[model samples]
Target chain A: MNSYPVTLKQSYSSALQAYLADAQEAALMRAYELGRQATENGLGVLDIAAVHQEALTQVLRPSSPSQETLQTVQAASKFLAECIAPFEMTHRGFREANAALKQQATQLANLNKELDAFAYSVSHDLRAPLRAIDGFSQALLEDYLDKLDAQGVDYLNRVRNASQAMGRLIDGLLKLSRLTRAEMRRQPVDLSATAQAIAEALRKSQPERRVAFSIAGGVTANGDPVLLQVVLENLLSNAWKFTSRHATATIEFGATWQDGKQVCFVRDDGAGFEMAYAGKLFGAFQRLHGRNDFEGTGIGLATVRRIIDQHGGRVWAEGAVDRGAAFYFTLEP
Target chain B: MNEKAILLVEDNPDDEALTLRALKRNKILNEIVVARDGAEALDYLFGTSVISGQDAPLNPEIVLLDLKLPKLDGHEVLKRIRADPRTKLLPVVILTSSTEDEDVVKAYGLGANSYVRKPVDFDQFSEAVRHLGLYWLVLNVPPRSKGR
Candidate 1:
């Protein structure tokens, strides 16, 4: 063996030496960093060698029997290999968790896209058959009204009415679907003005019906103005329809402070449903009354429920059969 | 009375017939030019395509545009109409079956003069059409025809 300079020899971790051995001579000094790290971790030769082969090989380079470098690098590498198992396990666990989360996110995104497509198809497909029914019924009435007797005319009328009701149902479904797809814009809405406008519209719709309205001033809520209008319109219209037989009908719009939050209410002296059906009140196409008693698509309350839910609110109804129905809805903070 | 004609751009034959019937029923007769789609509407207004057969000026009093059409939707048509300085101030009444909040907001934001939703009820639809036609034809004065 040739004699080496006193300061020329050094130890290395196996991994560091392995890397340096594959690299050029210029990379050996930089690769020695792993040996220092292994030493700092209190690793012995065999453990470091198994974990960091590159560093050990470089430092153990047998140029001219550098006995000092060979012994040091081998010891450090052997020591480091044992310490790496726990760290590697923890890293692998994290990698698996990350991969799982990514997969779940992709699945959720796909589900959302599928739901949107389904809504679109349902809305489009349902409208076509409804239109045909309405169109054909009207055509029959126009073409064969003279050939048919009173009974036939009545049958046609019923057919037309049923088709119209179906149309309303389709429209309601579409509205709900659109609401789901729509981007909501929240702003401060003047409840009093909104109520007044709805009241005015109701009055215009039935000029002969004398229905008095009371909207308390300074009542406001944060929501989409257009959607809130729909909410108010449905609630008020329901009140009006229910109270049609009443000699004197009164409708009130106001809000009350409940649990430190404003809970708005629409109260009317109208034909309200029994309390037993309250559970199904917000279900789509769930009507509490017979079609002959009061005409409705049964989706009004469902629409209201969806709107309230979107606004982060809750809706509930309180009333008896012939007394009055009051709907209370509150938006969350 | 402005000599400029009113352009009724509608695709459905039944809807077109009903609209014409309403206009006639209202008795506020102005020279009406009906185009079946957005393309035809543009052609009539620009004096291009089939409108070249007639010697009348291309300027229209108002454009009654439907949102949903077979070829070229209403929004794109509205954009094109607004982009041209010649038709920029033209009043476009968006008469459509869409009563969605987004549709209303978009039509108004696009500078539609009026946005009327088509009532599903036959009588109500007819009345709306009549009133709209009368208001645009007789009551509202058209922009000056000096440019054309």
Candidate 2:
């Protein structure tokens, strides 16, 4: 592209100069002089100064370099070098500008990732207290509403309801943030011990419930502890919560090897959700049961799904309304 | 006989109140000496020019250092404490709100004996204080004291 432009400009200017030097064609010579002045003043079709000396030599003599032509070549070379200097500088500047723009784009992407992580951490950390506040407040209102005057009871109930809704909003925000921030760490996790601890805690929460809770031992997998805990917590908490309706609530937390991958499941016998809405089970704020029937922020399953994805794993649920729900998750080998 | 002393270095009033309440609730029977900022903590620790009117020369069994503080930060205070032979190996425990891994690693690197993340919830916060006081005061044996 560069060589062709230089050649064309040289040819065009050489033709004009030839016309200017002609004796018989005085009118054409006058026209050529006028065109040359206009070109010098930046009023013509091209800048003659920009043409290369080699291109001028090609226009003057199509073949061979000569001793007499050397002076003309040098003059042409000087003019061409002067004209091309600014453009070369400009081209270099443009390259630097483009590189800077690319660097800024990378920095912006990094900042966005950090912001997502910050939002996730904040939301998750904040919810623990909000849980204690909302849960305990509701318990207070439900268990001791009669001792207080009407207005006082109403105020406490309002506080409880508002906090519960805030909990839902917080949970949703946390899931959205976790979609970007959550990263997978693969390490061998003793699933049996984790399940047993969760089961014992659940049973301790309700001693008289008479639930036959069983967790198979020796189940292990490689995954991020925090994310895997989220999966287990959600699944086991769901199982424990749902099975509250049964007189003999039976729940099992275990893992089985399926197709060379560890497949963990939390199986329960209680108010299981319908299979029709199973597709929406992992969606944020998508609740299978009514708020009155089941107490949930509805962000649990969404978190479970996100954590599994971070591990490059998969999650699914199977259940029939009023029978039971079983959530299955798989981790990399 | 030296009355057992604890140097509580904290900035925020609410946090200070919460911490004091937590300590008291956990039956930490030591005479608690409070420093509102890092400068004050230093003054009490090293007997700075601002607080030279010593009723007695100050020496605390344990310094509960909070990482973030106004004026001089927790790091500066820690450096000052560790620099002097009198207070070197004084069993500093960093108690802070931040759970950032860098801070954890840095605190331990700076010769802090233990690092405890300050829990946000009231009950949990109090429980952590209880365990902390019990562990530092009764369980872990302090090095033999140098003559004052």
Candidate 3:
């Protein structure tokens, strides 16, 4: 009887050791299935522990049973039961967590749909009144010009200006929301050529401004072309706007190797901000400069941050007052 | 002088007035039939509703369709217009304040001849109306109407 139990326990132990040694996920699953089968066939945890103790006792004493051996078996049984309890609890916890995660994902998807619909309606509805205000004001200026005084005309123009500014704000908000909702398509994009083109357009728009652009050759990235263009537009436009006061300005676009990864940068000799306010740079409507100083809706940098984030990239700026600013970004290789 | 009447399908009274002003300012003096809602627009086009009587202008030169309306939407109206043989080839321009990409793609997919986002500045809006009126009313040739 001692020999039979010893051989059976040795075979089971060896099988378990072989599977554990391989450490394959499938093998562990197989082991779990075997464990379940063994338990279901009238072999409880206590019985399994009793078998282990019997195997040890058989190995120690080849032919005879003793009171000392029985005591040892009881102690081993209690210890094995305690060891197995936590694993069962952990398995139950994992199942509950997975189910909860699935529920949350569904809720998130529904909320996104609701948000898209809300944005669409808001974009459509909000602009109508703005157009009316601007349009009617223009009408007053045009039709009632003979009867109205210069002050009246100025007031109407101010109303038109305010409404148009509001229109721009609404457009900016819509663009930001749309960026969040838009699907991204990734491909290798010629970022240098894109920057050069935008720079050329800026130059053409204001030929009197002597701004030199230095774009690195073959500087490319993997991202959605349209979104990347938006990024370049925002960054380059900022450079253009801030450098307007300078007699001559320089804007450079290039990439450098940092931490074994490629980091692209846009450097501009423009009106740089204080380091203390840098934290608020990428927030929507966060303007470091006064409206009188810089004409902006303050949505451009926020949009740039959002686009880069969507591309699984990072963006940061380094600047000092009147020294100029440089923006650096990185994408996954 | 252009004999074919133009259809201005807009919901908001303010927009309607502004759009009419824009057209007048641009010297687009073609007869314009105004529809306040998508349902009324469809009725005017298809002559299927109680309001579609002898006075309704059926064969419009161009349809300036707004996306958001009180009773049916622009998409539904465009779909009905495209589905019918009589109005299938009629030039329909999507004139709205929405610069959304989805709206543009959907409008084109639904067989819109053109899409123009209404500018907030009256001067720009007037210029856009002028170009639209000049192009659709005077320059572009229309397909023969069914003469219902």
Instruction: List CA RMSD, all candidates.
Output: 10.4, 13.5, 6.6
lDDT of 1 by residue, A1-333 (tens): 222211123433443455555866645765465545544454434444454455345554656547676666666665666666677566567767988999998997689667866865676556445544555566567768889898988887887777777767768777777776777899999989999999998899998998899889999999998889889999999999999988779999999998898999999988988988888988999988887888888888888998898899999999898999999999774
Error of 1 at B143 (Å): 2.1
Distance from true location, Cα of B111 in model 3, Å: 1.9
| Highest lDDT model number | 3
Candidate 2: segments with Cα more than 4 A from true spot: A1-112, A120-230, A252-264, A274-299, A330-333, B26-29, B49-57, B100-102, B138-140
| Candidate 3 chain A minimal-lDDT segment of 10 residues | A1-10
lDDT of 2 by residue, A57-87 (tens): 5556645658678677767678667767787
Report every candidate's CA lDDT.
0.77, 0.74, 0.84
Instruction: Kindly report the docking quality category of candidate 3.
Output: high
TM-score of chain B of each: 0.88, 0.92, 0.92
User: Could you tell me how far off, in angstroms, the CA of residue A123 lies in candidate 3 after the best superposition?
Assistant: 2.2
Q: Score chain B of candidate 1 by TM-score.
A: 0.88
Using alpha carbons, what is the TM-score of model 2?
0.58
Better of 1 and 2 by lDDT: 1
**Residue A155 miss distance in model 3 (angstroms):** 1.2
The positional error of residue A140 in candidate 3, measured at the CA in angstroms, is: 0.1
TM-scores of all predicted structures: 0.60, 0.58, 0.80
User: What are the per-model numbers of colliding residue pairs?
Assistant: 38, 0, 0
Q: For candidate 1, give the lDDT.
A: 0.77
